[model samples]
Target: MKQSPAPSLPSAEAALPRLPDRRQSVQSAQTGMVVLKGLANIGGNAGLTALAAHVGESPAKVHRYLVSLMQEGLVDQDPATQRYFLGPELIRIGLAAMRQAEPIRHAEPALIRLRESLEVTCFVAVMGNRGPTIMRIEEPGLPVTVNVRAGSVMSMLWSATGRVFLGLLDEASVRQMAESELAAATDDMRALLPSPDPIGTLQREVRAACCASVRDTYLRGISAVAAPVFDFTGRVCAVITALGASGGFDPSVDGRIAIAVCREAHATSLKLGCVGPPPAAG
Candidate 1:
């Protein structure tokens, strides 16, 4: 009789342990995204205990991850408050990521054009849960210039971009956002909203101010005009605004700059595949 054939060895693929189902894998990924996104939105330095509560995760689990993040410099703790904000490393990663996105890359040219045309500082801001974030800025050449640097966070209630964005969103949503998300206000923010009516008036004005120029308080001597920039989904993803010394921009010229800024924003939106019809001509 022929000898039995030697037993076959298990293949590498078969030798590996079986993986979890697709649904489980997807759930795990979604949970992780939620945690990271929530952390990013928490604003200034947050405590591990507070973060865990916010994310609805156990402190032990959050502590382990926070320690890991801290080691990698992706999160930092304030010595005074002992809370954590996004770390410099996270910002570096974010900048790198923004550089690779097509919408941001395309906005660069338009930002430069607006700055050159207006002869003042122009900023391109993207919507964030907190408010509008200054993603890019083309500073004016003047020695005494208003400096709004990249990553500056402007209030959705005070800044032009913030007003424009609030205008685009529905009333209920806007109120909900203001009350629920931005519940905590800074001293400056409290000063801006001396009464509740100003917020309502701003919202109503935002609705009427579409493709139009509106003035609101900034710092004591600074002012700006803003217009919305839509994305492919017809959602306003960004806003382009022109800022200058309060006295330097004449009302007539300011109107013209606002119109030009709006026009350019529309053009940029179209290039980005915004589905909505072009904003009514200014």
Candidate 2:
């Protein structure tokens, strides 16, 4: 008798299913995140077709993910427009994250990097009641002699740091303070200001440059560059400044030092939730 035909082995396709792999689980999580981020990048709301195109996924796959996100309150769709938008939970999470982000804390690393790489004194200055006040400072091994300290208040018309605030902040308080300072400026300080229309000219220049640099204007032999660090609302929350002896520092708007400062400020602003291109260096 033909013995029973030799036992046949199961083909791979006929084998029983194995448990889901860990990597697949991780990938699923990552894909979910991609969907969420894609929704945010496209003005925070979009039709399923648009969102699928933006995320480079099929509409069916995106819809499945969107359903899961909705279950978790991370996304929601409007019945009338049939468009998906970020949900309340996601907004709450973002707001909570923003509340935890401290401008000084976010800027400290940039300040350290600027100080070490550029061999200059770098600081974070905030608009305080007195004016722009230094909140944090980093100095190189051989620091320059700039009398200012952590709490030192800078002059709106005299300091590179203050000028960034003066140019970016549109509040009447800032303008009033600048005017008061200009009115009380000594003959030497007045002479140092631009002729004809110092305030108007300074604001226009700083806004145009997206940064401010001064040479031998704030203090004798001292040069500095300052760039604004904006918050999520595109408001100037602080200024990052790097200063050194005029002989060693290049304060030109397009110079290496200024570009570095602007880049660093832009990075710190990103950490603080600001969205946009980096501040213009030149």
Candidate 3:
């Protein structure tokens, strides 16, 4: 026994797997990121105490970091309200990002395909500051007569694209927009605005269907069918419209081009992450 003492076994701690050293991790970056994310979520102006609570940091600590953020132009404090807001840098970045977005960039090929297959004039319209404006256009080789260009603004009540946006906009907003149009209405447009009821009726119908149609509303003998395209935020990012002679294309909910346009719009919407019917058109 004295000559054969039992050999000692390795300890349990030595039997465990090794974890890589994390000494290179930057704690300051972690704090800065946390603070920035918190500020973004808070949105608008926030005071020191309010922001501190929102970010789960002490007021003094948050203030110190905010000062650093201000130096980088990532934050701005109001001299009057003593509230902090996201700075001009974020605005500049956001505007730049939006300029590059071109929501209908990938949708052009689909528009071309639809036009070629349907033999109808097709276009994408997005809500603009003035109203629903055509962003892109695709036409069949044949002589079509609707007279709309890429910059053309459509009637919020008369055109299919316009109706879709009207359906998506709130009542007050629609009323205000309608009033503005009415103030500048020509004799022809005055005829269109006999009363808001007609436009209201169209808005209700479009909202119910998430689609709309126009026959001789914008142009006599011209008919159009439009379907709403939704984006990730559930807003109607764009409207796809198919147009041709009144007799050539059907504008009903179950019409030929209506079905096709809706299908194309649905496919486009899916690409942009829409899961349900469009919620907004802006």
Candidate 4:
């Protein structure tokens, strides 16, 4: 009829994809994430009133959700102080989310211990796309001014974390990391390599000893020692680094800080399901 009414144009609403039903969405899950985010922002245990303020929820509402989260083992409240902190179930879930997520949840306790014992700024590093990058840090009351923090990329050939990555990563990965940095280096910087074997030898020793370090190389008066955290595949998935002043921090294998880092790394690796101690070396 009338050439089908001149072929009616498609409505703009019709061109758009249909959204899922709002009623089907779980609002509670979104609320849960908000509560978790609020807890993280608070950085530790908080009283009911403080937590409510942080999450912008009423105390009664926060308490109800906290009770539910506690039942699910996602949040915990201290019986003595009535303060809230994250719970163990969240740790398990976080660890399960990534094969190499030791540093995200499992390594914090060890990092805290190291920081307290060594009075240094200890951090966890992982191989980010750019290079070895800091993922977490725990420092003493008076932290030093090294400038690197979570997400800071260390030097592939110069920084302790980068050296650990260079030392422990597979050959192909090591080459890729180095080349990525080299490709970005200026001509003058490229000419500064000490020799052809400058980094190769260190890689060998680092792999053999299962750790690496760089002192007063990147930032004068700053030093770092990094020990490998192996995964079930025995690959160095991450590293624990303790950075401090030049003289106060030792990169030596047997030194106090090195031993602490190596110990924590090994323990975390074991927790991640790597074989224990290589059968005691016979």
Predicted structure with the largest lDDT when compared to the true one: 2
| lDDT, model 1 | 0.70
**Tens-digit lDDT track for model 4 on 129-248?**
777888888989999987888989888877777877886687686777787776787766555444566567767767777777766776778887888888866887888888898876
For model 4, what is the error of residue 66's alpha carbon versus the real structure, in angstroms, after optimal superposition? 43
- CA lDDT of each prediction against the hidden true structure: 0.70, 0.94, 0.78, 0.79
| TM-score of every candidate | 0.55, 0.92, 0.59, 0.60
Candidate 3: worst-modelled 10 consecutive residues by lDDT: 273-282
Ranking by lDDT: 2, 4, 3, 1
TM-score of 4: 0.60
> RMSD to native for every prediction?
15.8, 3.9, 10.0, 18.6
Tens-place lDDT per residue, model 1, 228-280, is 77765567778887777677764232367777777788877877756455554
Clash pairs, model 1 backbone: 45-84, 45-85, 46-84
Ranking by TM-score: 2, 4, 3, 1
Per-candidate clashes come to 3, 0, 1, 0
What does candidate 2's lDDT look like per residue over 1-282, in tens digits? 567788999999779788789999999999999999999988999999999999999999999999999999999999999999999999999999999878999999999999889999999999999899999999999999879999999999989998999999988889988999999989998898898999998999999999999999989999999999999989999999999999989999999999999999999999989888886789
